[model samples]
Target chain A: MSLSARRIIPGLGLFVLMTVVAVWALWPTGGKVTINDRARDLAAELRCPDCEGLNVADSTTTSARSIRKDLLRRLKAGEDEAEIKNSYANRYGESILLNPDGGGLGILVWGLPVLLLVLGGVGITIAIMSRSRSTRLTPTESDREEVKKARGK
Target chain B: MKYSARWIALSVGAVVVGLGVVLAMQVGNDPRIDATKSQLVGQPAPELSLRALDGTAVDTNTLLGKAVIVNFWNSWCIPCRNELPALKEFANRYRDDPGVALVGIVRDDSTRAIKAYVKAEGIDWVIVTDPDSRAALDFATRGQPETFALDANGLITGAQIGPTTLRDLESLLGSAQGR
Candidate 1:
């Protein structure tokens, strides 16, 4: 094959491999279990105070540890998940939860990421198309002459 | 021009790979359980105001003249529940000592639950409630069953996180008494 094509092929392969690996490595495992089934279900919906990105069960923060203990206690006491979470929300406020109740600013935080991703994809597509159009050109006589000379050599 | 573009892409890929490796390392290093050793020793005791179970307000100011054992706990915490009996015994043993006072700070728990737990466990210390959890925030407490021994000057002489043994309690009390 041509030298330029050979060089480009390896780079493209590396790029694709890196993208796949990045997505795989960073995907959330959600190692959720049913220790206190009711509490686990509730905790799955609650955000961890120390590590806000994860649910309570998935977090290892001291606060999360305490919160999980409370959840289990409530569960064992025959309190349902909804009742327990509601009690916690009353005490600590709704921001303690991972999933915000529908409506208001909570919905906005949830929606913003998807909106940005769509906008970014559209912007990239337009930029790529515009760039390709601007850079494209018909081959000149000098280019053809060079190719012919090179082929002959 | 083509080769340069390829080189740029490859460099970017390398950087992304390096970043991923660093993040993975950090995640791997994350501690699974809370460390039992105290991080608050040598630091000044955090200011706190909590209402005793008897409905009297207790603050750091109240602890000024005496060395105090400030135990952060909650009725909902299992480890705290497990450690309460030992704490109760220790407080009882030191009850008559004017130089040493044992105080319990109920963290982020309901007053009703705390009262019930205290009653059931026969905990006789000055049990207090931090409904706002201001004390927890100030102490940077990650969970329940953390104990801090403060000198007469209100400086933290020693601290212990998680469940406390009778031996740990005695050593802390002994050190505070000695100071």
Candidate 2:
């Protein structure tokens, strides 16, 4: 009917659509550890010795597959994630873990993302403030009087 | 000249559209396991020297001239244990076949336990023990019950993780022979 109503209707529809999509994307797939999920998780943790910088989960190498199988077995046995990881660490050293543990140099890995987010927010705020200051009109009394005279005329 | 809000919105929309297109392309181009060629198909088999239960050595290099199937397994592994009967039978069936060799690599398990399991199962194939598991790492073995099919030239032709059927083994052997 009205131009504003038409614009509002589309914006509302878009908001609903976006909300639904986000929920669907973030919806829990039930258990945290299905057979495949555990396999994938293990794969992500275990480094593929054959493939540089790629975890077993991401690597298509034969070694990775075997590592995945091992991970699956460990998962099936009701072994906790920490124990499974420890097992790998025992055999292959700490480098086997894709993400380092949350201590020592590993702490930096986890902390950096948070630090970046905070810095980004601060940078954006500063940028907005700087831009507004540069573009803002500072009206003198003479300019205001001229504006008042123009309005009167 | 300064851009309008409309231009900024358009740029953001363009970026979102570009990201969506890239994601779609990636999903579309994702290869099925069968469609993807195995990288290990032609690579030299990883060298390993592990001792058999009888205190004898089973070396990959020594088996270079023969078509060998190196099966990594352990008694503690359920899948490995589950697949033992089928593997034993397969090994038996192919035992007389001079072109085929089945060697089992025991990973992260004690020699005594492996020997007991092999004896209980009556597994007649050559079983090797990787107590230190250095051989396992060398073979890039992730877990037990993984098999690598090696050609006569000691090049790995196929690798199967988890329990595989006899049919799977035959197909792998067929592929190795270029049949």
Candidate 3:
């Protein structure tokens, strides 16, 4: 194969891989009526209102059981996962969500660390480049001796 | 230039510490950072029709013209027990008030336990059971001892997430009235 073909083939493979991953993440598992897999996955994402820091799927509390039942009902009703999540969020304010919304203050909480990391990377890159350039212009021993004698060292 | 870089670092550190302190102060004042606040306030209360501990069906629609106090509690909850005396007193105070109704919802508990508690506590108000917790879920309760005050049109006027005193219940009930 030609060089360009070889490079393009790998690039195409990477693009296809990324597309599959993205689609997998956004795929709707909400309409699945199985009581265990999809329903339980969705339940696990919901906060158990009566239990402290426990997800609905994990809690044995009656309230959690009810919530799980409600979730299954909605799923069986053919509601989309996002729709079910939004329904709870609307009734409970955004705080009820185990995962915060992508908008508003949640964006800040999620974005700040990534922003700091990128900025730190740029700073480190600049520092390394400047240090390397200065080292490349290193003075000879004669030059150092001349400077030392001039300074009466 | 080196001194300036150090100064910038120091300033950034100071700002971070200052922000942390401000957040710390707020943490004490607002411990419900993870708790869901009432989104039902000012919204029409969801339909609640459940079997009372007395085996009678109690529905919110029948009490449409009356100010309603819907309290969600369970027999097992300590906070629910703690607020029972205040809740009882509030119920008695409003017992003669035909314009107001106080309804308590027992969550995730048996009728036998509730009946025993109600008799022992002398609770003379309407206490209902949320069999599947549909009403509690609709109300978006975080924990037990949550209370919601609704106006005559069945619109929620106020909501309390924790145990409330008689004064608070009175204020919540009063606000729902004449509105």
Candidate 4:
């Protein structure tokens, strides 16, 4: 390998390693994710049904406060997250869920964007690889003479 | 992209657009929009047991087999006062009906103010106070003058968000009776 490539390859490897370490450090550890954390996150995702432009966690409206308390209580009582969310949906309708689910019609809202991005990446990769592999003709002495004549003209 | 890949993407694009149109149509006709117009409608009437202004205990659950009209109001709300005359008349008319019960629950007002208003207005319809608005939140009430008419089976048959007219109350009661 060339001197530049050797230096670049090691540098790139180190950079990738550091990025992975940083991500691992910053990523939420499951051990630290308590019911309170889940409750807070759930509240953040619940739309304050009686308010404009505020989630249950952010809104101080009576309805918002009530739901927050209800959520925490239910969470503490051993009900799972999805069941609690479904109960809220049944009570307040699905609009109360600010974040759509990953499945069902909600897939259109979430999965479509991710799928499109992946497809776009694949398309770009294929295009670049195809262009690189395309045939290239080498210039003969006569071809070089013709190019020199064109430049002179 | 390869020809096959291009066609796959195009097909995905077409399907997405088709789903988009369907979703848009669904949103346009969504009954939830109207469902939230009065959130308590089509929901089971929440249970409430309270002490009336006259020191009498009133439990809504006991009256489950009868048509019940729950009126949420406050002393400070103008609409509540405006609708009181009709509510009084409605209550009077239903007093001997045996099949209907009208109960008024105070909201967002002090006990003193409500007592004053209830006494001064001669408002005699089983007036009760909802502390901390617990019952109100359960009923999904936005504000004062919200009314819910519930059927014998505990389902809320109809709801009104604003001031109740005699006609509106009558209509709601009729809906509760499956008329």
- The candidates' DockQ values read 0.04, 0.04, 0.29, 0.36
- C-alpha lDDT score of every prediction, in listed order: 0.72, 0.71, 0.80, 0.81
TM-score sort, best first? 4, 3, 2, 1
Candidate 1 lDDT, tens digit per residue, A15-51? 7999999999998676765557667778788767545
- State the lDDT of candidate 4 residue by residue for A1-153, as single tens digits: 974576458757977999999999998776778888889999999888667778889988766777788888899999988999887776566777889778777777787778877777677667755665667678999999999999999
Query: Chain A of candidate 4: what's the TM-score?
Result: 0.77
Q: What share of the true interface contacts does each candidate keep?
A: 0.00, 0.00, 0.48, 0.15
Best of the two (1, 4) by TM-score? 4
Candidate 4 ranges beyond 4 A from true positions: A1-26, A29-31, A102-104, A147-153, B1-16, B30-34, B37-44, B96-99, B152-155, B177-179
**lDDT (0-100) at residue B76 of candidate 3?**
82
Poorest lDDT segment (10 consecutive residues) of candidate 3 chain B: B28-37
Model 4: clashing residue pairs? none
Q: Which DockQ value does candidate 3 get?
A: 0.29
TM-scores of all models? 0.51, 0.55, 0.69, 0.80
Query: For candidate 1, what is the interface RMSD?
Result: 10.4
Identify the superior model by DockQ, candidate 1 or candidate 4.
4
lDDT by residue (B68-124, candidate 2, tens digit) is 878888798888878777787788788898888888887667777878888888889
Which ten residues in a row are the worst by lDDT in model 1 chain B?
Answer: B28-37
Poorest 10 consecutive residues of model 2 chain A by lDDT?
A: A127-136
lDDT of 1 by residue, B80-113 (tens): 8788778878887888988889998887778888
The complex in candidate 2 yields a DockQ of 0.04
Candidate 4 TM-score to native: 0.80
